[model samples]
Target: MANGVERELVLLFSEEELREMSGVKRGGEYIEVTCGCTSHRYGDAVGRLRVFINGELEITCECTPGCDEDTMTPAAFEKHSGRETARKWKNNVWVIVNGEKVPLSKTVLLKYYNQASKNGNGSHRSNNGRVCHRDEFVRCNKCNKERRFRLRTKEECRIHHDALAVANWKCADMPFDK
Candidate 1:
């Protein structure tokens, strides 16, 4: 039973992964746990796992770029990815699915996940950039006229909104130059 538990720990967290997550110095004496009662070397083959698995050491997520050293229990660590998986993205970290970036409007769903994760949240912007949906009348500064713009959904709104944003005009009737 002890060996099986040890195997699970090794499978879940490699020594390197634990080191990165713990934010301990490379060649220091055995690092101390949060409780300050137990300590183990980051590279220890068996003792490292014992420190973590036995709950003698608390696993804090120090790997993410802006993480605040949030404590991640062994179970939480197992449920999430480690530092190595973070750099796999060529560009910014995105909520990709099946090798495709999810759309901007769908970002609300990702926000929900971020709240649940209680740790490093995914990028707030989409690859497409900011997409604003306006469903009201606005006075155009250039033409000095009121224009109505209504965008009900994300899919139907991005292109139109992006184009109007670049042109810096409200609607066709309220053209910028005119």
Candidate 2:
């Protein structure tokens, strides 16, 4: 089973701020691109980002209406790092969420998503390659505070349910999921 990871993208401007700066009127609705390819909308809490994870510099138009013409042009955002293997356009950017800046890099993202195991803990991830979200209770070793969250169970197989297995839980940030 593959473990899941979460990576964040930090934007320079908030989605709302970007809408204002880009001359997009807000009506709590999706805005149509100049070419009318497709309408774009941001969620109430989170905004989506279209980013390239490969080294290729392929740019496409978000314009709907079936226009084949490319819309946005790629600009040199940063220099290539020594560890980065991308030969062309730097596919790295930042996103802002809740007034916090999060760096989005292809290399960094790839490093995170490519791993099948946790950095230290081997059992925190579910068989579905995601952080366990099943309800569980665990006492922290440091603060000794019992934190309950939704994570997966050890005997979670394809068959019967185990109501008695409720107490079998993982720790909160323990060296291992004991």
List TM-scores for all candidates, in order: 0.18, 0.21
Worst 10 residues of 1 by lDDT: 41-50
lDDT per residue for candidate 2 within 92-150, as digits (tens), equals: 33334334443344223223232333223534565675655335445545575776443
| Model 2 alpha-carbon miss at residue 131, Å | 5.8
Which structure among the candidates has the greatest TM-score?
Answer: 2
Q: What's the true lDDT of residue 147 in model 2?
A: 64
Model 1 per-residue lDDT at 129: 64
* Candidate 2 clash figure, as a count: 15
Best by lDDT: 1
Model 2: residues with Cα > 4 Å off, grouped in runs: 1-20, 30-137, 140-151, 154-178
Question: Which pairs clash (backbone N, Cα, C closer than 3 Å) in model 1?
Answer: none
Residue 170 of model 1: what lDDT?
46
Q: For each candidate, what is the lDDT?
A: 0.36, 0.31
